[model samples]
Target chain A: MTALEYIRCIGESWPTTKERAYFEALALKEHGRLSPEHVPEVYHFDRTMSLIAMRYLEPPHIILRKGLIAGIEYPLLAQDMAEYMAKTLFFTSLLFRSTTEHKRDVAEFCGNVALIKHTGQVVFSDPYRVSQYNHWTSPYLDQDAEAVRKDNLLKLEVAELKSKFYERAQALIHADLHTGSVMVTPESTQVIDPEFAFYGPMGFDVGAFLGNLILAFFAQDGHADQVNDRKTYKEWILKTIEETWNLFHSKFIALWDEHRNGSGEAYLPEIYNNADVQLLLQKKYMTDLFHDALGFGAAKMIRRIVGVAHVEDLESITDVSKRATCERRALDLAKMLLKERRKFQGIAEIVAVIRQF
Target chain B: MTALEYIRCIGESWPTTKERAYFEALALKEHGRLSPEHVPEVYHFDRTMSLIAMRYLEPPHIILRKGLIAGIEYPLLAQDMAEYMAKTLFFTSLLFRSTTEHKRDVAEFCGNVALIKHTGQVVFSDPYRVSQYNHWTSPYLDQDAEAVRKDNLLKLEVAELKSKFYERAQALIHADLHTGSVMVTPESTQVIDPEFAFYGPMGFDVGAFLGNLILAFFAQDGHADQVNDRKTYKEWILKTIEETWNLFHSKFIALWDEHRNGSGEAYLPEIYNNADVQLLLQKKYMTDLFHDALGFGAAKMIRRIVGVAHVEDLESITDVSKRATCERRALDLAKMLLKERRKFQGIAEIVAVIRQF
Candidate 1:
């Protein structure tokens, strides 16, 4: 008989204080109850201690990033991720709750300001400006990082995203949803490490996951050898990116359609009544979300290569010259995506661009 | 010795509870300290008793709306109001403070949800749909009320504004900043009755003031009789509207410029260093704010006409037919403003439109 195993996860944050961790445990336990299918169950939480007792995934379950690095393919990854993102984001948004409930939750999560500030600093602000924390592949990518600082248009887009992240209480997001934050087997996917969870733009969450995957795909070139060319794996990565966005779009719309008559004050049934109106709103909303995701995803990618926190997928490549080449390709694409995201329409076009690179 | 008079104001809202009043008092005490020049000075606050004891304006400081109805003018009205709006809104926004400070204050003010709900329903919701509370000049405005319910394009725009009202935590706004909210004289202007205060879109506050002025302008026709035709007074009102917006725009930009190197995080100085970029951002910000004010102003106008609360300017007119004629013109202009506000670039165009109406 399968039994439960408990794991103690204590909060140790940047300032070496329990505050951020307390919020992390609180966020996981708080939002985990809302959607339990993909998130790990929180067994116990001690606020003062900044400790959390959660489920222990067995050895067979590896971090999604590591699996990607090993050229492993999880066929159901896109479907599972789409469902996870859609449910977690949709249920927490104004589409599902009244203003009273939404505001209450927003205020409660705003207490997680420590992590939110950290994110606003690292992912949004520090990447563009010269900071002691910022790093890159020296000599090879120095000019590239300098270029990022000087690109006024890219900086302008980033400022918009930064404000959106701070202002839009669109949803309670699992604020850090990179591949390293996910654990999976062939049949199972579990989301974890929501230390940065707060009411932020939903696109930030979607972008984080997709941007990390893009990082992993670029690193595949460095990992390839005579035995494993990793050509099929790279193709799989592109297909997964396309499928994830498309599925999320459809699933998010389906939830909205289902809850059209509920207490959600965003779109009253008396107002958005006709099929044509619904179609119009849906298209407009998805288009905005699509662009938001692309812009944010590109920003996240740029930060990984040039900002403080380097992804293991790139770091583990070992060969500095080859790794820089792969990184430069990702960097150039991210810059394009960040600056010209509005011009992009569908994920297929994005996939086409990836193939070109 | 000059002595100050005091007034005890208790909150008595729709549901007949002390909670809304407590928040009102707290909001006054909390945000009132920021700009006491315009807002009435709060002397005491008893939260449990749901009471606020504030400075009492002596005689000659009549309600601004009553002054407007009597064809009285305050030459300094636009200047004082512009400074008031710019100071209170700017100091409390992310443009003047860090996210940490802003979020903390946002969460604190979210406690005033009772009035926020009342506003969301009456100002934004109930006006769009049928409700027993909604009333108009029966038989005269019956068609106009019904037309509001059937106007799909108008309703679409309302949905957008309503969502913005809910989602955007732009600044601390005097949630009900109508003409009645102010007590004015030839020399001194004292703003009072902030019982419906909370953190909301700045446009809501600015729009409330301007929209009520527009109502007064329309009602000039009905209030006209044998002596004092109110024609010249109406022109002064139009000029006041133009001056108010233009002054507020300049003063707001001045504040942003003054604090560009300060703690405010909206437009970080490092990224937005260049003159060209600053111009681009200012134009974009002011444009969006102008449109938001226009849209919200139009909605406020619509609700006053067809919704539960009828303004004294229109209601005091004895002839129902003549009053309805004025109301119809205001309603038509408001509908156009709501739908076509984006096309407007400056306050001069708006003043021109008001003249045509």
Candidate 2:
């Protein structure tokens, strides 16, 4: 047993982990069923043992965040990710599935409550409150952390987001779909570690990716040295953020158009058959999703700065004062984005806002 | 057997009926756990037989709608109903319950999916689409019904609301809290027929009550005669509507304030401990809730007019043309409310709007 594979053993001690592995296996099975090209094959699953064995994407396939830190850009990353998101999200949602199927899947994923609770605490609650688990760069960023806790507007926005997180089961979300959750190479991008997967707002996954990329862009200043100014890498990160949302919008709409006659209970083909109404429906849907993505992304950013889990993008930056400055800038941007997300019209406006900070 | 008590019996052919009985029992139990006064006592529940035997509010406890139609004013109607709404909604919500308890109840009520589906259709879908189930006062208001179906803005607003109805499980709601569901007299108000209870937006319950009151107001003219004129009764209905919301607002806040230090996971006492932030949080929460209630109430009104079900208020108006006029005014008001609900500031503003229509 030289750790050739990860085995989530069934035991009295790790009931939460055991359940997560089971849910992850179930979610992956569902993902494969919906879109196999985007998912890893489950080699074996033992319900009694609470274990799953899956494929290994060997070397060159590194965590996307590490690749970003190394100033390596995946050419196909945006395109591949958008396809996976549109497919997995559309296929699993009430926009594509029957209510019967949707409710059954929702009920099953409700058992993934532990992972959801973890997210609820880390993303929504802990950051806004004085929590023992919460940490940031000490003294240098102490005031910034306190400001976050004291920002009534920010907490108000977060409270709405938190309620959405706990209550809204819009679709099956890869609840931890940050950059670190992705394994990438120059030509391939694979989503991994969906152990935190559950039925949640699709924007949560979208925000995690985009928000982490923004964090990556900010951290580039710290990662820069004499050898590389990292200016080009920073631009590349920004371009990826813009392109991901743009590509996702186009791809999601294409899927919706393709499935207009499908069994999506949200909009019946008979009712939404008119072109004008269809366009209006899609525009409203995408706009809401965009705002949700921005709001959730900002919350993710804020939490990484002030909540329990710190992201490697900023954490990898060594200088205490320098890292604090970077984190503070990101924090300010996140707070603004979270509060004013509804005012945003498109990714272009968002990119412009990102450039401002 | 002669009906001494309300015994919903089990039957092979009516499995849904059996399930509904069980759910009703569960909801009543939960409601009683929170507040015993407003809800009927569940004496016996036989899961195997799919039956529930509950307390009967005998004699003067006629349906509230009947009281309104007969021009009978319950002096304590506002106080009793508001208390019920505040207590039942607050206690069962994430505001009071832990996430574990909340999610568990939410899941249990999700088993009441059949009723949820009915609401999704009748309240959200049928009014916007040309469904065969849709009906109206025929010839006179055929155009009004057609306008409801054709109004793009109305449908767009409705779509968002529908999604919320399906996705947002903010609290354990009395899904059908219309006047027909209440048994009342001068001294008592008891909510009954919670067979459609489920975890949904609290506004659905609040909206149902207020919207029905609006319908009753509009129908007063049809019920008027030389003997009584019914103008005073209409004024009374308006007063009750106004007071119900005002009182409900105060009572709900009082509950929130009282439990500000409790286990409500929404706003942790540590973070929202500041009086300013707490006030801000409550204001935001209550404002959002008001908009939701208005939107949902408007939807309820619209469905009753042009969707599958017609309320006794409008249906009892013998003159077809007279009835159409009332229905059309209601339809217009509902459309405006659904589209411009966010513009409303408070119960006073809503009352003003109702007077204009």
In terms of TM-score, the best-performing candidate is: 2
lDDT score, candidate 2: 0.86
**lDDT digits (tens) for residues B1-357 of candidate 1:** 122757575536557357666766766665567767677777777766766777777778899999999999899999999988998899988889898998898888777776787888888777778889999988999999988987878887887788778878888888899999888888777777676777778999999999999999999999998898889999999999999999999999999999999999788887678888788888878898999999999999999999989899999988999999999999999999999999999999999999998
lDDT (C-alpha) at residue B65 in model 2 = 91
lDDT of 1 by residue, A1-357 (tens): 132668575535467357777777877776667667677778877777767788887768899999999989998899989998998888888888888898898888888887788888888888788889999999999999999988877887887888888887888998888999999988888888888888888899999989988989899999999999999999999999999999999999999999999998787787677787777777877888899899889999999999999998999988999999999999999999998999999999988887777
Clashes by residue pair, model 2: none
DockQ of each: 0.59, 0.61
Clash numbers, per candidate? 0, 0
Off by over 4 Å in 2: A1-15, B1-6, B10-15
**What docking grade does candidate 2 earn?**
medium
TM-score of 2: 0.96
Which 10 successive residues of model 1 chain B have the least lDDT summed? B1-10
The C-alpha TM-scores of every prediction are: 0.95, 0.96
